[model samples]
Target: MKSSTIRTFTTVHTWTGLLAGFALFIAFYAGAITMFHDPIDTWALPKQELADARVMDKAGAMMADIVAKHPAARESIGVTYAAGHPSHEVAAYWMEKNGTWMTQAIDDAGAHDAEDHEHGLADFVYELHYDLGIPEIGIYLMGIVSVIYGVALLTGVLIHLPNLVRELFALRPGHNLKRLWQDAHNVIGILSLPFHIIFAVTGALLCLTLVALMAFNVAIFDGKLMSAFERMTSALPDTAAMTAAGPGADAKTNVPMLPPAELGAIARKAALGAGATNFDPDYMRYVHYGQPGAAAEVRGTSEKTLGEYGMVALDASTGRIINMQLTGARDANHATYSAIFGLHFGTFGSLSLRWLYFILGLAGAFLFYSGNLLYIETRRKRRNAEQPMKVRAMATATVGVCIGTCLAISVTFIANHLAPYFGAEPTLVVQPVCFITFFAAVAWTFWRRPAKAAVDLLWATAVASVLVGVLDMALHGDRLVRTLAEGRYDVLGVDLVAMAMGVGFGWLAVATRRRAVEGDPCSVWAARSPRVTATTTPAHDG
Candidate 1:
């Protein structure tokens, strides 16, 4: 490439990265934690009682009771089976006309209210990953950010192509801080290039689905794309469409319905016959329950497949398989969509793959962090004078949004542990607690100098993380011992991980404090005055 071309690419890379770095940092950091979503939920929430032999009967009763109380819910309602995980409560879900869902556990003592489904720690962390804790517009905003991130990735590769081989592993951490940061950023970015690209592509596609659908409808489908698209993705016949024309569609019937266990067994057999190696049905949605036209859609996860999830639809009244779309039997379009989710979430492989993804996610977060550091270092004032306003602003933002996010999430974990003691539901307070801690930490970051705030927040995060482990032990010691005796490790893993993160944060705090106080007198990270003696050595440029 020409010198001007390289410069153009470099500028593009820099601007795009700066534009998307903070959001990507939050996404990656939270996303890493979400890799262990089930385990984390298990660790933070109280366990549900083990299901009895009559659990299937209870599920069936719950479904019937829901439709009995609210006839309108006969249109569509879903019930999730526990599948041996107490955290996976057997719950019923129905959407209200106003576009909100109501959930009720099968074990509830009385009639359930129209309360919205309560999200656990894993789901909330995932919201931070994709939505940045914002609802409605956040996903779309992140879609645009993902586009810019893709551009940054391309331009970055272009700008570094010439020197990539030579500087790929260069890590000179001497007097040239800029050189050190640059080398570290390059190393991580290059190593995680594929992972970043996968996220960029899939994230944009997932988040911008509506936009793409609109564009495609106008451009190629002549405005008839949605129906076809829906059919392609969901092989099952639309219940609303069926209800309009099928037998007994206009009225409810008094016919006895098949047992929930039998429906699940039929779905499981269908999935296995359709080539899923192993299928565990966890969710089933009923449409027109107790009627001749009733249908049930059972969805489950499959092991050892590109499509980690598969669905089997059945006639609810007679237990006849109406449609089957398992991992191996899916059509091209449905398989493609399922594969996207599997690849994006590392759900197609073993637990080890999830762990690998977790490590990569944390590394990706660090990659963006180091990119910001490189930007600040590259712009640092060299003459032992006050730093530029833009430089300071970037430093403040880097500390606030990045490190503050860490502290906020750690505090959120603490809040999760503490909520039960006050007789509050953790699910109800998780969102409020996360948002509050996040905004407060950001305000604190802006209130103090960037370097000082970074160290302070790091320590806070360390303390908060340690407290998560401490509280888990202090509050649930007896339960933890009992669980361990039974060979359950999820809760133990979470506690250990929390304490480990605390140690990491503590080390970072000490290191940051040392650098702010003693590393460089003229840098933005320095706590001392910018003035230097005449005989001071000049900083080296890489």
Candidate 2:
């Protein structure tokens, strides 16, 4: 690329990254934790004493009773049969009137109280990743962010192309702070380029689905988009077929739906026959229940496959298999699509792959953070007694949003452990607590010097992370011990990871404080002092 072209691409990269970096940071960090979604879910919920066999045996009866009591559930109900380790009890889920999902756990006696369930810890984290916890609009906004992120990635590569290979592993943490940050940013960005690209594309696809559907409906499909999508994705079987016995047969008016146990068996058999061997159904939906036209679709995951989740539909009246969509048996188009989804979510491969994804996710978060730092550093007016207002503003926002988001997430975990003691709903308070802490951190950043604010936030995050593990121990020590005794490490893993994060954050705080006091005084990250001057270091060139 020519020098002028490089400058233009550099400008593009800077603005696009600045615009989308903060949100992407949150998404990446939260997404890192979400890779262990099931473990976090286990950590949040009360200990499950019932064995998987016990839960599975009674699940059918419990679900039948649940549907009998709450007919609304007949429309759609999710049954969680098993989760990786420290297994959750068999549970039934349905959406309440206010749109809150209600879950009822089937106990040892094959009974449950509808009001007893609470949301999982990882749910909020997952929500923050894709939607930032804001409803309808948040997802759309993130979709736009993803598009910008993709453009930024492209421009970033174009700008770095000349030195891409020569400086691939370059890192000089020396007097030139801007160079250090630039090198770090470029290194991580290049190393994780493929992962970032996958995230950008998959995120856009997932979040932009609604908008794309609407656009295609009017622009290309001529109102036939729904049918086209169904054909492409191989959606559930048609409900109309449930009423017809065969071609030219009279439609049945009403018929009772099959019990959960029977439907589960049929779906399981069909899914296995369709090439999904370890098919464990986690979600199901019913249409026209207790009528002749009733049908059920069971969605599940299979082990040792790139296509993790698949579905099977069955006739609810006779427990007969209607249709199957196993990822393992999917065609080239569907398989490729499903593979992208699986890779983005880190659902394929073994535990090792998941760990790799987790590390890369946190690295991606740091890439954005370092990009912000580099932006501020490059723009700093080092000669002045104070940095430019915009540089200061950017610094404050970056510190407040990035560190604050980590602090807020830690607070949510603390809330998760503490909520039950006060008879408070964790789900209701998690988001509020997170937002409050986040905004308070931002406000604090405005009040304090940028360097001081960054250090303070780091320390606060460290403390909160440690406290989360401490509170979990205090609240659920017995359960943790019991799980360990049973050779299940779900809850134990979360607690250990929390403490490890605390240690890591605490180390960062100490390092950051030292750097502020002793490192390049001309840099924005250094504490302001009379000795600092622009002439101390040469101006950074893009």
Candidate 3:
């Protein structure tokens, strides 16, 4: 393409990134915490703290109880396993039509009266970051934004090609107008380029590929694709079919199967034989329970993701193993499918990989935000005031989405704690409230002053999110103290992260406020030139 063509694309890249930047930041920020979903869940629940806790028996008794009450759970659903004591299992969830269903969390031990799900808060934060709080639509839109983001990255590289070397690591903090922003934008983007690339590739693929995949199913895979997928999924055998109470059949013959602990033990043995260790099977299911063909299965995970080797499904009746996919053996087609999901979800590796991704994802968000500033900066002098009013309106929109993201995230942490006391759904309350409050902030900022809006929102995010970190320590200091007392490393994981973010965001908030009060060194907020009235000779006078 010609240089001009590339330039036009550069503009597209710049605008898209800027407009999408703030949301991207929230996504990255929250997503980094989500990497510790299990740990967070641990921090939230802390089951191990129970003085009477015994991990093994808990699994069996819980499963037996859940299953006996919800017997129809046999054929329809898979299982979920945990790696705890007393019982390592919940019966896989079984839903009948719409929302009506029986849970498989327990068997013979008798079932509880609750639904089979957990973790309201963490899951909500995750969804917000990825989907922007909308389900299907939000994810898809973010994907589109990601693709355009790639374009912006390419464009940025080209524009700065000549000066990149000299200004590459430059962070000239003082009075130079262009130099300051130029340095801030450039250094951050370059330092985090790899992160940007990974997120863009993964994010776009996750968001935008569904339709393309559907097309692949149509154009490439024969109509048999769906069936192929289903068959490839493991089967459940320990579940029972509906009894007709035929002429000779005993309707009362049904007895719930073995204790969950025994079945879990069998599962662990099988998984070990299959070359998978740390078989913390916490969920169980019987596909055809009591009918002589019933099969039970267990599924769970290891500490970090790499050793997970995925899940294994086995033959329940004989404790005879049918198929397994724990390690590298996890069949190719299935592996590709799984890998895409893994890479997108940021769950493919060891500690280092996850952290690497966490930092990069945040950088990617910054890239988008910077692209926006570059866009407005490039054009302000030309349009000045005389530019069409709609052009001015667009600037307002970009600022809203970007700053709005920071504001919402800052609120999410506060909302998490507050929502619980109000007897509200923490996730629902935290998310929507964050957004609504953020939108209000943006509108006020825009009407009041766009530049000021940027500065204030940043500060707001810094305070709210940072304070959340501080408060977490303050509220949970006892627990953290216990963690230290017990010499458990994971406890420090939560503590250090919270305190670090608290300190960092506090600093950022102060910085932005100072910048606004002192006047930013850059003409960062310079307005477009005023429009000129066309002069004409008065007909009579002339």
Candidate 4:
């Protein structure tokens, strides 16, 4: 490549990476945790189990209670089952008069509002991965960021491809800090190029689908884009037949309804027989539950398929399958649509695939981290000269947002464990606790030097991670032992991962402190002037 072309690509890579780096950092880190979302939910929430003999009885009762108290729910009620260490109990949910949602959990004691614990942590983390926790616009913003990331990825590969063969594995360990960092960054980026590409494409397409539809509506379809798309995607052959009265409307009839378990069984048989390799009925949605025209929709996850979830709609009164959208029945467009989610979330495979994604996701987070560090290192001034203001700001943000996010998440875990003792709802405390800790850490970074703040926040994250894991295990030691003996690894895995994170963060904190103390005096990371030498000898920390 020509020198001028190299410079152009480098500029594009730098600017694009800088623009999207922090958001991608949060996304990657949170996404890594979300890879084990079910396990985390199992670890965090109280487990409830009903005997096989009584499970159907409890579900039926729960469904009946929901319809009796909230007649509006009879129009469209969903019964979500409690499958294998469910984060929550078997419950029914529907929209209320004010448009808010209401839920009723199964109560063994026959009491109202038995929904005690809320496993919102996993969901919140997953939201952070996609939206940075912003409501309406955040996802769109990340979509734009993802587009920029793709450009960065392209230019980055362009810059490195020329030297790929000779320097791919040439990770020189000594003195020249920039070369070492670049070497590591290049290796990871090159080796994981495919992973990053999947994210860049899927993230953009998923988040911007609505935006694209709107654009196409105005530009090409003459306002028929959404209608056309809906017509194509509708599961029901006759969409009008599936329509029902809005919330707060009364049911057309007061006839008896079939048991939930029976409907679930019918739906399950329909889905599996339609070519789903594995189906576990998780949710059943009923329209006009007690009416002659009542219908049911059952949705569940399927194993070892690109389309991870399959659904069957039934005529509830007769247990007759009305429509099936299982893997074998899906058309090309629908299969592709479903596969997007499965590919992005690794839901098409077993536990081993999830573990692989988790590791790669964390490495993706480190890629952005290292990108920020490279920016700071490249812009450093001479040994005796003052560092640039932009360099300082980037360093501060890199430490504050990246490290602070980790600290906040760890602290939120601790808060979740302790919320019940204080008579607080765990779900209610999640957002406030997370944002407060995050902003405080950011404020601390601004108050202190970046070098010192990085060490402080990392150490804090380490301690909190360790405390949440070890202390929780201590409180539930007997249960842990029993579960271990019983071959249940969900809770044990979460606790162990937490402790491992602590160890990782602790090591980072010590390494960063060491780099700060002994690095070049003019380097932004250097805490103070070195007594041993005046010569510039930069040190790096990753």
TM-score of each: 0.94, 0.89, 0.76, 0.89
Give a tens-digit lDDT track for model 2, residues 430-510. Answer: 878888999999999888877889899999999999887888888788987887998888788888889899999999999
Q: Is candidate 1 or candidate 2 better by TM-score?
A: 1
Clashes of each: 0, 1, 53, 0
Give the alpha carbon lDDT tens digit for every residue of 277-334 in model 4.
7777777877777765677778777877877777777777678788888787887767
Candidate 3 or 2, higher lDDT = 2
TM-score of 4: 0.89
lDDT of 1: 0.83
Candidate numbers, best TM-score first, in rank order: 1, 4, 2, 3
- Whole-model lDDT values for every prediction: 0.83, 0.79, 0.59, 0.80
Model number with the top lDDT: 1
Stretches of model 1 off by over 4 angstroms after superposition: 51-56, 108-111, 238-241, 252-255, 530-542
Which has the better lDDT: candidate 1, or candidate 3?
A: 1
Worst 10 residues of 1 by lDDT: 533-542
Q: Please report, as a residue range, the 10-residue window in candidate 2 with the lowest summed lDDT.
A: 245-254
**Candidate 2 Cα errors over 4 Å, as ranges:** 48-119, 231-235, 245-254, 531-542
lDDT agreement of model 2 with the native: 0.79
Clashing pairs for model 2 are 255-292
On TM-score, the candidate that comes out on top is 1
